[model samples]
Target: MSTSRFLPALRVMLALQTVALLLQAITAGLLLSTPGGRGLHNASAGVVLVTALLYLVVAILVWRPGGGSPRAVAPAVAMVVLVLAQAMLGALHMKALHVPLGVLMFGGSLVQLVQVLLARRAVAA
Candidate 1:
């Protein structure tokens, strides 16, 4: 497969992850504030869920044995694990861990973005 096709998909995944992370961060802040509400929690959870799915799709595409090498397999597995952990944290109302998880999620997305960009550049050259 051409790098251009997969790279853009990867970037879309990263962008989704980034937005999810930001939403989590903001939701964490709101959760810590006065008069707690379920709305914010639900919203954040939804965002995380959607972004996790997006990441999963990207991971699958990248690691697909038929289309590419097994390079992204590890990261894809890690991302799935992270998504589950993050969801668990949310369900358990572990607000303290939200920021940290958001940071980790963002870092993971950044790594994916960098990898995609690098691969695309190499293919272009």
Candidate 2:
């Protein structure tokens, strides 16, 4: 399969994950300040996890030998695992780890998105 064929789908995955990450951040702020924000925060956590998983799936598809993608597979998988851990930390009320890990995940996802975009540019050029 052509690598370019997967580009659009990969881009969509990146877009969804970006939005989910933003929502997750907003919900985190809400959770800290609003009494009723817990529900929204939890719901947004689920969104982040779900989108990360979906994004990973796409990454794996692109990583398949046939996909010809330059993106690394390990980081995508790690992000999924980290998100799961983040959820567990939140559920167990491990703020010490949860808060820091959330920040890490935010940075990681943005980095991954940039990598994908850079790969696309490199391929096009």
Residue 22, model 1, lDDT: 73
Candidate 1 lDDT, tens digit per residue, 28-93? 677768456457856877777777777667766765633765665567667777877888887887
Q: For model 2, what is the error of residue 109's alpha carbon versus the real structure, in angstroms, after optimal superposition?
A: 0.6
Pairs with backbone N, CA or C atoms under 3 Å apart (clashes), candidate 1:
none
What TM-score fits each model? 0.75, 0.88
Question: What would the per-residue lDDT of candidate 2 be over residues 29-76, giving only the tens digit for each residue?
Answer: 998899978999999988888888888777777767446554556776
- Worst lDDT run of 10 residues, candidate 2, spans 65-74
Provide the overall lDDT of each model, using Cα atoms, as 2-decimal numbers.
Answer: 0.70, 0.79
The weakest ten consecutive residues by lDDT in model 1 span 1-10
TM-score of 1: 0.75
Candidate with maximal TM-score: 2
